[model samples]
Each structure stands twice: as C-alpha cells, then as structure tokens.
Target: MKQREKKELDTSVQGIIIREMISHVTSEHMIGQKIKNGELRKKLVEPVWNVPDGFLLTEIKMEQFEMEWLEPESCTSDRVLLQLHGGGYVGAMRNAYRNFAVVYSELGHGMPVLSIDYRVAPENPYPAALEDAVCAYRWLLQKGYSGSQILVAGDSAGGGLVMALTMYLRDHHEELPAGLIAMSPWTDLTSSGESYQTNFEKDPLFGKTKDSLIYNREYVGLEDPKNPYISPLFGDFTDFPPMLIQVGSYEMLLSDSVEVAKKAKSQGVKVRLHVYEGMFHVFQMAMKLMPESRQAWKEAGRFISLFKDET
Candidate 1:
C-alpha cells in the first residue's frame, strides 16, 4: 500500500454553507416527506437542471430504456462517456444529469456523453438497471465505438453499477472500457463498512438514518447483498481498467470507496482514490459552487485524458 497523505478539511464559506444546507434540507425525514408529497423529483431537478451554454442534447429511445447524448458544440474526440446517474437505484434520470453530462463532456476534453435513464427499483428492481446498462454498452458497440474508446462514469449507486457493468463484461467475455470514474460509490448493500457507524453523524444526507441511502429491499429484491453484481465490493477486479474513485470524508459510504480501492489495488488493478475531507456524499454535484467539487472534476478530466486516445 502507498503511504497515505493527510488531507485538510474543506472549511471554505461555500463548503460550510452547502454542508449545512444539505443536512437541513435533505435529511432523512425531509427526503421521506418530499417523496411522500411527490415533490422530490422536482426539488432535486430544479437546482441542477441549468445546463451550461455550448452543449447540445439529443434524446434516443432504446428498446426498453431511453438515453440522451450531450455533445459539445465542436466535439473532435472519438471517445465517449457512458454516464449512469445516482438516485439510490430508484430515482429516474432527470435534468440534473443533463447538466452533469455537460460537465463530463467539457471536462473530458470535448468528448460526447451518453447518459441513460435506466430502469429503477420497486418496479424494475435488481437486474433491470444492470440489464439496461448492458444494453447501452452494446448500443455504443454497435454504433462503432470500440470499448477502448469508451469510459464509464457514475455517482452513488450508479458508481457501483459501473463496476458491476465492467465485471459483467469481463465475465461474459465482452470488451471492457478504457477506464472508470466513480464518485462516492454505494458499493456495499450489506451496510457493513465501519464508516457506516464512524461517519454516521457526520454524513449530511444519510447521517440520521441507520442504514446507508441505497441499502434497501427495493433494489436488493431477495438477492444476496454480497452478490458482486449488486454490491460490487465483493466483485473481482482482475483485468479491470484503470479507475479513479472520489469520495467525501464525511459520507457514511466513504468506506465503500476505500474498501473497493483496496480490493482492486490488491488484485493488481490501477486505482486512484481521493478522499476529500469534510465534504458530503456526491458533492461533485456542486461543482459550480465548491472548490473541492471543481478540483474533483478536474481530476476526472485528467484521468479521462489518459485513455482518450487509446485505440
């Protein structure tokens, strides 16, 4: 293992205010109330739907799911980013991801982004999201984009999905992408990581809850929580592509990223893990407002650049 560096907590005014705001607004009770009142989607979408200028969005209908392509005004790179969004495996793709897709495209050196609205849980459940991911990857392959020219990126549950997707590809003899980028991945549905207790009170969004956000029955659906396809922390990482994982120190799922990085590294995978102190889960969503978030995205761009030209 490499020597661990001490990281300073983000004590910026914006960081402090944002953390408080998230804790107050999206606390477990507030989220439950929002879901009950049918206002969660709107509330989540309103703040992040503002797509930056100079990007174009095109919607495509798959056989069972929908995907949107976000292209820059003058994209010259052949590489593409397949984006899986995070909403605890239950939330549908919204305009927030459209904005995120813009960031991925611009920061990924002008490559186009394909963001999917994969099927979610309680209705679609376990294998549905995974199956949809496979379909999207196959679509890209059929469209003549080699797996080497693709990168898979996601946040939260979507982050875990990217790993599961890669594992599935490897197991089924399909080609893998050039790399992966996961932000605060929810890799362990078992909720066994020590951070679940250590950072419980510090996690802004999920601190108040006994279990992490995505460790619910809706998605697991009678499947083993440790199933590599579901949890991914239990998955094999042999022959996996280079990966960049970013997680916040204050998140209950912080150990999810940490443990996965350790496992991948042990299995001879190239892994870069960044633990940003004092930030909350998926803080990259605040890239426009927080310095730490911006730095995280810049790191993502640099990671993407490493394989953007690979054949």
Candidate 2:
C-alpha cells in the first residue's frame, strides 16, 4: 500500500476556519428555542449557497418529501443520487445544500441529485424524518429507478439518517441502495463519543460536549437516545452497502464517524474513512472556494459511480 501523506489544512480552508464556520457561533439555548419555535430558517441560509456555473437546479415535488433537483446538462437520467441535508434534526434544507448538491452532480459528470427536504424536529420528529426519507426512496423506486441505481448521501443528521434508513430497509427486507456517502454524519445523537469532549475546543459548529442536548431531546422525544433509529451508531451495520465517510479532523462529531466506520467494518461492510486535517464539520458546503471541499465532493461522486452497474 502506498504511504498516505499527512494532510495539512488547505490554505483556502484555513483562511475561512473562523470567518465562515467557526466565528459564527450561537448560544445553544437560543438556537434550540429557535428550532422549536420555527424561527431559524432565514438565519440558517448561508450566503455561500451559489450554484456553480454549469449546473441547473429545479424544484420538484415528491409524494412524501419535496426535493430540489440539482443537475448538470451532462448528467444522465437513469443514475440518481438522493441527498439529505443536515440541520441537527431541526434546521431545514438551506441553500448551502442546494449548492453542494450541484457540485456533487458536476463531480459525477452530471449525475442527477435529488436533495430531499425532509421534515424536522419539535413538530415532526424521529420516525417522521426517517419515514419521509423512506418515502422519498420508495417514490424513486416507484418512478422505475431500481435500488441499485440510487445512492443515498447525507451530511450530519442526514448522514445518520442515511444509515438509519438503510438499516430500516434491511430490517424490513426492502431493497437497499447502491451505496452510501456520509459527510460529517451525526451518527451519535446521544453525544457520547470521546471526540465530543476532546474536539470540542477545536470544533467551530458545536460549542461544548453537551451542547446538543436540546437538539437531541427535541428530536428523540419519548425515545431512548441510544435507540438504533435515533442513534445509528448503535445500529446493526451488517451487510450494509459500501460506505464512504468523510469527516474533518477538528469536528466534535469526529468520533461519531469513526465509531460508525469501526462498527461497519467489523460487520464486514466495505468502508472508507477520510479525515481531512484541520477542516471543520460539513466543510463540503465550501466547495465553491475551498479546494479540500471540492476534492471531498469529487470523492463522493467517485464512490457513487462505483456501484452504478452492480445490478
């Protein structure tokens, strides 16, 4: 095996470490309240959500969940990538997700991407989001796309949902996806990972070890935090499709990805984990300006392409 070089912070990524993601910290209590009251939508839409030069975005309605389609002119209609945007189970699908979806499409040489706008917490919680995700997949299948032609991708909570949704399908003996691409996935909603404490200072998005309690409580409502559906880190990953997991070195949820990767590997799943040094959570949203983010998007597209013909 070739020796992997130690990754340093890309200059572009380093420049925005504080300005783009880190410096923009909000109080945990207020953020949670905003989520509960449904007032954080505008605040969560970052200005960085610009569609790239060659991609086209069209809003489409689904039977259960509405989605925005991001497609490049070169993209094929048969192979589709379904995405779930992250919001800690409360935040809605923001513009940043649309931008990233386009980038993912471009990277895959124009593979169409369906960015699902699933329901959120404090209103429609837990199984609600999961149900919407499953419904979206079912709608896709109903549209004549086989399970092997669809790849599931999500960031943060969406990433956890990617795994949870797949596990749910497996348990129900439903068709599985071609593969999975999870970026900085929040697999452990319980906030029990060691990186939650160790990387707390280095992470810019999540402030402290216990900062996610309110977000967790609001989403998990009346359910065990460690329940496999809520916290996929504890779920059975055996016989899961191939997985591509990317996480930043400075993220508080780094261990969440690491633990999931370990468990999935132990269960004989083909898993690849890439830790971008000095990067923060869900850094792919910076694909427009950050080289590493672009590279991460490329990696995800490549992973998705690997299974386009396994059927």
Candidate 3:
C-alpha cells in the first residue's frame, strides 16, 4: 500500500489523500478508477478482519452460484438482514461487506445475513444490478422467509440499491422488505444535488466534477437518471418502510440523503437522519480505527435491534 503524505494523513483530509494515492497508483479519476483498477473489486474476496467471536460463516448457493452467509450464534428474532455491498454499482461483493453485516448480525444476536454478489457495471450495468438484488430477495422469500422478516441495508452505492429495490417492489406491488438502512447513499445519479458542487472541495469521496457524473451515464446509458429506480430520492416514498439514513457531512451525496429524508418525512414514512461532522463517505468501514465508525455501528445496532423487539 502506498503511504499518504503527512499533511494529508489528517483524518479530515484522509479521504482526499486516499483518492490522491489511488489516482497516483492507478492513474485514473475516482469514479472511473473503480472500474479500471478494480480497487474495491480486488478487496472483495479478502476475508473480513476483526469479526466478533461466535459468528459462523457459510457459503450458500443460488442457481448454482455461491455467496457468503454469516450465521450468528443466536437469533434475537427470526428476521434476516440482507446487505448489498457498495462499489458505485461497479464493484464490491459479499466478502467485501461481510464485516459490517457480520458485526451487525452479531450485535443483533445472530439475525441471519445473506450479502449478495450482484453483477457489476461496465460488464453488467443498469437494471442488471437491480434485477439481481430483486431476484436474491425473491429467492430468499421462496425459501420461506417473509418480507417483514428482512431488513435491507447497504452503504454508498449499495445503499442506493436498497432504496431502488424498495421502489421496484412498490412499482410492481411485490413484497418489499420491512425497512431500510443506508449509509451515505448515492441517491441522485444525475449528480444534480447542490452538495455535489458545494461540497466538492471538502468531499474526499467524490468531488463536484462532470467526470464523476459520467459514471452514471455509463451505468444507466443516457436513460433519465431521474427515473425513480435510478434515483430513489426522486421516487415516491409513500407506503415505503421506515428508513434509517446516515451520512457524512462532507460527502457530495450529503444532500441526496437529506433530500431523501425530507421526502420520506413528507410522505409520512418513518425516517431518521444521522449526519456526522468531519466525516467522509461511509466512515463506518473503518470501524477498527475510526471513532466515528464505531459510533455509526453502535447506532446501527440500536436501530436494528428494534426489529427484533417488534417480532
């Protein structure tokens, strides 16, 4: 791993420096870099470090394909939480997101977690990723799990996927999950949010740039990026499940979460928004090192525990 500069090592600037190093090593911008260098892709197979004790991992097959499943030692309830890993619709797999899911499952006292290995972009784009999620949840239901027993969750692009899946279900009148939890969700693929420009310099995850917006165009292919399925912030939130949204103050998608929350509230959907200061996109990923990451998980644990009580 390339070391970041001393000045850039400050936690406030750490996100920016990480991008600088990525750009330096891979010679590509952040948006396009994920696809070219497989930055997030290559890490997906690596086993998660620091998983809590007593959580057993198993590999389960779907249609002759396998994905990771984290089975906890005990179940606070009969529910399962399905996680969609985020890599801007182009990267990430079950292994990459296992740590958070496993920890959440463990914290919730062993609610089952089945994180998907959904198809990614450039190779599989647009509805391919969305369809895979829908299919995975449907498969789970076919296995006898009710919709109310599932809580959908993800971070960044995966966060967006959860919302999209809910919207898809609402559109088709199919069974949707009980609730959703998103971390720094990239809800507006059109990149029209003012935060995209206002937070450009401060947001190390993604700055305001037409280049970053191009990723959406590439993934969605000139389709209306504002389509409800493409941008859940632009979708109807009425009758949707309760949502817990957490976002860093400096990310370009900050407004996306805020706007989504506002809409969810307007539509009478239960919504809670937690905005952290001096944080950068999906800070929870650094749980072992970052204080904010720990706090984020703590909050997630509390929120997720509610489902068990309800059951």
lDDT of 2 by residue, 100-144 (tens): 676667656667888889888778878889998998888789878
User: When superposed on Cα atoms, how far off is each prediction in RMSD?
Assistant: 3.7, 4.5, 5.6
| TM-score of candidate 3 relative to the true fold | 0.83
| Model 2 spans with C-alpha error above 4 angstroms | 1-21, 24-58, 62-64, 73-77, 212-215, 309-311
The candidate maximizing TM-score is 1
The clash count for each model shown is: 0, 1, 0
Q: Cα miss at 160, model 1 (Å)? A: 0.2
For TM-score, candidate 2 versus 3, the one ahead is: 2
Give per-residue CA lDDT, model 3, range 1-311, as digits (tens).
34434423444445444445533543445534553434545454654555568777777776623466778665555888888888777664744477777776766677878888887766776887788889888878987888888899999888988999999988898888988999999899888888877887766545534444224555676578888887888899889998999998767889989999999999999998998766777888877555667778888888887776355
The number of the candidate with the highest lDDT is 1
- Give the least accurate 10-residue stretch of model 1, judged by summed lDDT: 1-10
Mind giving the per-residue lDDT tens digits that candidate 1 earns over 15-86?
778988877776557565464223475346444455468777788998889998888888788899999998
Q: TM-scores for all candidates?
A: 0.91, 0.84, 0.83
C-alpha lDDT (0 to 100) for residue 51 of candidate 2: 64
State how far residue 192 of model 2 sits from its true place (Å). 0.8
Better of 1 and 3 by TM-score: 1
Residue 253 shift from truth in candidate 1, angstroms:
0.3
